[model samples]
Target: MAVSHGHKGINFAQTTSICLNFIQEALLKHQWQRASEFLQHYFQALEDFNSQKRQVALQNIWKLGSAILYHHPKSNVETFNAFADRMKNIGVQNYLKISLQHALYLLHKGMVEEAYRNLNQAESWRYGEMSASQEKIIKLIQAYRGLLDYYTWSKKRTELSKFDMDGFATSAATQDMHSYFRQASVNLHEIIKIPGVWDPFVKSYVEMLEFYGDQDGARQVLTDYAYDNNFPSNPNAHIYLYKFLKKEKAPEDKLISVLKILHQIVPSHKIMLEFHMLLRKSKKEEHQKLGLEVLFAVLDFSGCTENITAWKYLAKYLKQIMMEKHLNWVQEGWSSRKDWWPTFHFSYYLAKKNWKENKILALEKAFTSGILLGKGCKYFMYVSKQGHKVQKKSIKTMKKFVMKHNILDSEEL
Candidate 1:
């Protein structure tokens, strides 16, 4: 429960817990500086301890390092360097886990040479002492190496202009860079084949292949590393797969599969909107109608009126259907919603018979909503020209509305 350090008996577990609590609280409050101080104190307290204590200390330090990297990147370089030095001083015998963290930090900081040195030191440690997870970490480091090689080569090749190259020189150089990156991609794929390196390993390879204009290759990599039925559960992964499918111009069925996956993952307004857009583009009339049905269902369930854009779209669609079917309910349904009056502006252009009346009504509603004009004399003049046969009550209403809005001075009005 507690370990005595020197002057006072330190409750190691309690102190660690307190430190973690402080770190999380500070992070939640966006106090990165205080969080970093607490983390440093926490890790320093665990130094000079034995293996079990050191493992706990190292894990905390690694987490601290990750927090610094993600949340306080610009100001945490010194913290990262100090952590790296601490890991190095722990010696290769105790450095397997920390090595990957240090290497990643070094790579992020663009110290590729130092990162490789750390990786080499980690590799030279006695293999039999290493756990299976540590072996997986080493494979991930290999994948990181391949990533570094590909990026470095790509940078160099991009710096060379086409005009700077002679005929044979250009051809030869092009072949070399292509071959190098292709090999790097292959090496990354090989690491992916080794199970348990899922997150960054597969993600990085997918990104690299996608960046290199190899959509098919990237899709294949995802398929190979696929998590069986557990797939389509991650919203981000589903979005990525959908993008790839869209890029490939895969059939409507494939796009529908992604929409289904998205529906299963999380039922949200955004997902519904994307499904509607995709179905509309795919020209699946039945599916588009289904998407509208789903939208209406979600609207009823959530009562989410924040999406004015979706409302506008529905209004336009309803207008079209009303014109085609000569349905009064469609027009009434659209006109009843005061919040959606702006959408009827588009309908005015397409309302064949009632175009003029609809246009005037849309403008009137827009003016009343304080949207068309900023309470200027010009706006009042424009409203006057509408010739709405302003009654005394209507004039009183206009004056009250203008006064209630307080949007302009008396002289301005």
Candidate 2:
């Protein structure tokens, strides 16, 4: 059903409050499907309200837009445009942030000139001395301008532009890629010196250094970026250093050191899979255990939830670890977990060791009804041609896969 602003008693703020309350309630219960329905209803009401009226508190408007960006998976360019336009129409304070974000969206879409124009608009708002945050924004604007100039030069590499030649050296009369890179370097240099996550600026500076055959400089810059105490704890900084070292063919021990530190920081980093695979082949037992943890993580990923291969590996590994006790473990999901791990291989073993057609049908019927997982759902309809009430015990493996400290090698306590 659609809500109408024409309703005499209904208010936008009240509607927003009610809609968000229900949506959040659903989300708290891990009911994403229900939350999605509530979200759609809220947006539908918003659109209806927009047709009749556009006046609202800026905070309310911000909240409305933020719901999509933070909660919805389908947020995109058009959504951002709508959000920025809403903010701009009300002459929102800190307006440069709106332009800056819009500029980033344009850059993402490859609208380089348009993005530069947005940065220019943002920069124009500055007057007199700026605050620390404003200063950061200004530097970002200049950094983006450097990127724009570099992009322009790239398109015109062989563009017959005049050059200023010096003994065995020459510089373009107008800004070229090299000169633009230098400009980017200078703009980025000071910004990176202060400890902070300067992803874009640091990347630009490092790339410039590498292009100018300053490998040593690039290495040191990445080293400082990763290890500097002034910077917040960040895994990507270390990952950047690790990649740089790998590309430079740094020693094995050095590569391992960075990887170890990164793993200690973010154990479930996707890149750790390759390292774990090699660890699996190592002669050490501890390394082998760590290797299998990656498979567990792979299975935990949304798309890989149904991955049978990973399930099989973990089951076999579990059996190996348990030895004689493997068979003693019930084939049914009577036990909460397949050991105390983050994922279980219940499906593989359940199907293999005990697959009576009737038992499968019963399980399906249980899922489709309020008997096992609660509330009947049509999504599980295909699992059984006919569903009837079944005992909750028939269902197996609601393994609490909460990964509190999944990393095996604990930091020294």
TM-score of 1: 0.59
Best prediction by TM-score = 1
Please report the TM-score between candidate 2 and the true structure: 0.52
Model 2 misses residue 289 by how many Å? 8.0
Residues 348-403 of candidate 2: C-alpha lDDT, one tens digit per residue: 33333322444543343223121112222222222232232452333322111101
Residue 273 accuracy (lDDT) in model 2: 60
List per-prediction Cα lDDT, in the order shown: 0.58, 0.56
Q: Return the TM-score for each candidate structure.
A: 0.59, 0.52
- For lDDT, the strongest prediction is 1
